[model samples]
Target: MTKQTGGKRWGRKATGESAQVRDGRPRRSRRNTFREDEDLEEQINFSDIKRIGVYLKPYLKQGAVILAAVLSMSAIAVAIPYLTKTMIDTVIPSKDPVKLFTLGGVFLVAIVVYELLLRYRTVAITRVGQLMLKDMRRDLFTHIQTLPFSYFDSRPHGKILIRVVNYVNTLSDTLSSGLINVIADIFTFLLTLIVMFLIDWRLTLWSLVLMPLLVVYVLFLQHFQRRAYQRLSNKQSNLNAYIHESIAGVKTTQTFVREREQFQTFQEQQGQVRKYWMKAVHIQYLMWPGVQNISTITIALIYYLGITGMGGVQVTTGMLIAFVGYANNFWNPIINIGNFYNQLITCSAYLERIFETLDVRPEIEDKPGAVELPPIKGRVDFNDVVFKYEPDGRNILNLVDFHVPAGSTVALVGPTGAGKTTIVNLLSRFYDVSEGSVCVDGYDVRDVTLSSLRRQMGVMLQDTFIFTGNVRENIRYGRLDATDEEIVEAAKAVHAHEFIMELPQGYDTKVEERGSTLSAGQRQLIAFSRVLLADPRILILDEATSSIDTRTEEALQAGLAHLLKGRTSFVIAHRLSTIEHSDQIFYIDHGQIIEHGTHEELLAKKGAYYRLHESQYAMIKTANGEEG
Candidate 1:
């Protein structure tokens, strides 16, 4: 049954080119190309602030405790100044020892209570900050896992790492303590202002005369400060991306003797980081000193008015002292509020990047009411299939049509980039068809849940990935519930048991990431064991034996033949000898199948498949003749 399909593509193509020589200069990695536009300027918006508030909602009880502590602290702050005035104006002059000692004891107690509240507030704020950081990182990581392959393909891994780790950390303090302190500081400012007014309204007005100057200075610095921080963040991400890429490709760099060149590139990126950091730090430093200078002027004005009696209001020594204390209390909160505002500006840069990542909807999410696929007999069909990596890109697969009976072995023979792997990718639903249906057991792959559909298929790519773990554990990854005995059986079937047992600890021997300690042939054997253990209904082997020696390849054929029994399989390989006996052989080129037949039938036809076979046969004979 043929179904015609055409619609907007779900994923965008990455417009990065591979590294190559051009104009006598070695080109950069594709990952670095995408960073060019990543530093676009962005302004913090209300939505970003509102989303941060959502993360804070779960810790409201703790926030309330913090609020109560702040208010109680503020009340004590105001009351202490009044107590000082009472001691000087009334208690000290009374000449009564009882009153004097009683006032001194009360002052000491107030100081102790204030310190205790301050300590509690610090602990509470830290607890809340840490909790919010955990939640933010969890949500970010969870969302990243759901994003389509294209999202990762377009950007460097280091950029994503920084957002999950560094950016989230940058916002934690601002979202928790910074936000709470801003609120507390405002209230404290009001309390101090009111008390000062009651003491001497004239002096209070004088203290606030320098407020306009402070406001103008803050407004002037606001735009430059935020922009500087944003640039710094961009530069930091670029440097991290280069560092990660360098580490991953260190072998290639050393093999090519390009260490000096790589180091030069590293220095250039690091210099950018340092330059932007200095710019941002310079802007941030200006804010504190500017506020402090304004604060100093305000205090000087208050003292001048109170001491000189310039406004003709009589001022007693105790009233003057109490008013001065209130004035300090008022300015301290302003300083705190200014610092919080600076923190808000800095965190806003991080928040924009974090929310931008979280806001991307997964392009390949299950549709509403999608159903789980039941176990299948592995009958697969590609009906008029057409695909493009990009919406407007050239077709990677065009009008391809085929069907495979259940339990049949099919070989896809083609040159590199001739849509061989893409065919299996569609069958596995790693990508959706651009204009056709990929159906297994008559169910379109997209109609089923991803986990249920992919669970029954095993794919081994050209590059085998062996995670960091013991040999036994790595084999068990394919089927987590498999027994140790079953793991050994699978390894033996793939001809991997000999080498595994040869290791110092046998199956318990630990391998580093990517199996760097093992030979390429050994890694391929382990990968084969992993896939075979799963007992998948369908399997795809894309150049699975490319890394193995001729002797090992010959040994693996017998085990592979037994595993392939009663399981539908697709094989892609350059060495045609391995697939000469496949139930069906397809010679695919330029996204189209040029020839299709069994080995003998294609040889009789004397077409593209026959010519390919003859050429490979001649090469082997020539090599043997030369050796003889």
Candidate 2:
């Protein structure tokens, strides 16, 4: 393992090969090893700790209270040992009833005060910790939003979720109580040491003879403890990623009767988590016995040597008794400190992962001095555009040059993987071109703020995602401030109003997550309605009408044509009718436009486009007995 350096950052280029099959399923690996980064670094630097300190800065007043409580609690704990000595040597031996009662009352009052301070400390620190967590999680989620698509593309949903939820919660455990306990233990240890020395310095020195050995043993165990926790953390992330994938694709699993297989995979992941946890536990458990044995030996030495009055220096019974109490306090605090150190080691791994994500700069961020895109006229130009998903990979689009006049309809027709979607992705600036520029209204896309550029463009993809919400709420997602009337009008435009009204709760009907409660066609219509409500100047419809029935599609096409009349639109479709009315068509092949013209003009050319149209849709036309 590498020692952590002060400076290391998450590189922008998402680095990973596709671990998926042609069917879009992740390839399963039989290898039992988790992400065992042998060169994984240890030690979060002071700068990262200071970043955390910034979170605590806002709760300084609460921290002051907690500090006061901790000091009070520690003082009371030390006082109890001294009070026991006083009672045994003074009040009880004096044979005065009044004095004994006074000492007992004082002890009871001290206990009450200690309890109150402990309670206050718990409440205040817990409140402060919760507030810090809220701030941290918010910052993380907000930062995630600003990240480019490639980050999400390379990482698993479950892994991200774990960082936001479980890992943050783990940090909360350390911040809220673990840290305070460490501080209290330190104070208790020091106070006990001072009092023990004042009582009998010789005995105190003798009792701590085994201290260096204990320290050495704990320090050795720490390295193993850290390695075990790293493995455990990696296993948990893997398990969560698998579970998330499984749950997200449960319908596919059930339909294909792969539940048993998936269950077996889950069991394997679970067993790995348990095995790693046990290894960590094995290391942690060693501390308890090691500390116990050393502590026992220390006390035995103190008692045996003190009975002989160390070098003719006499020792009183009360003083010896007090020394023993202080000895227990001294050794036990070491054990507590060891436990705290172990927790810090475990938490450090999680902290590193979280910060690594935060350090990744967005690959497609606007350049310095980028401006807000003006109201665009929607004239897009691709000037010798070249792109590849990977840095050194084959170009997906090679020297592509095109100009789309404002407010024109262009149909993209191609085979799968023929760069149909890649063109649109570049146009939207979802990714930057590798070797050339994509310009919107003469302004290079990279020179404009992403929000201003994307806000004016609407894309409806083949796979429509519907967030869990009521029908009205889902429609309003496109324009957050859109009125209910405007939402209804948008739905009506897409011919979704009729079906939506027929539902039990109409517009108020609650949709399940991913719109599972809605039919495919219904979800597509809702997605169309959302885009319509947004009323973007540039519209992209990729297989938009594929899911609707013939009659419903006809109705939707009318609304779509009305919506598309004055906007620059790009359409990708397989159906002949969907592109039949397009103003121009670009027939692409092998990342180049082989043919481009209107439908009739392309037919007259009798080239690639003509053959493609005839072979692809001619059979369907013949089956319907329609003129080809």
| lDDT of candidate 2 at residue 76, scale 0 to 100 | 85
User: TM-score winner among the candidates?
Assistant: 1
Tens digits of per-residue lDDT, candidate 1, 1-628, equal: 2222343444344233323332344333334441452643345554677787788899999899898998888888989989999988998889889999998999899899999999999889988988989999999999989877667777888888999999988886786588788888898899999888888888888888888998988888878989998888888888888888898999999999999999999898889889999999999999999988888887777677777889865577888888778878898898898888888888878777787678666656577888999999999999888888766788777778899999999999978889999999889887788777889999999899999888999998889999999889889999999999999999999899999999999999999989999999899899999999999999999999999987888889887888899999999998988998799998888888878889999999999888988999999999989999
Off by over 4 Å in 1: 1-37
Assess candidate 1 and give its lDDT. 0.84
lDDT of 1 at 65: 88
lDDT of 2: 0.81
Residue-level lDDT of model 2, residues 1-628, one tens digit each, is 0111121121123222323231333332122222322124454333445477778888888787798789788888888878888888888899999999998999999999998988898888888888988998998898888776666666677777888888888888778876667888899999888988888777778887898998899888878887787778788888888888899999999999999999999998889999999998898788889988999999888788778876554576777777777788888788888877777877777776676556655667778999999998899888877777766667677777889999999999988899998899888887788767889899999899999999999999999999998999999999999999999999999999999999999999999999999999999999999998998999999888889988998888887778888899999987767788998898877788778889999989999888888897767768678643
lDDT of residue 339 for candidate 2: 75
Question: Which candidate leads the pack in lDDT?
Answer: 1
Span of ten consecutive residues with least summed lDDT in model 2: 1-10
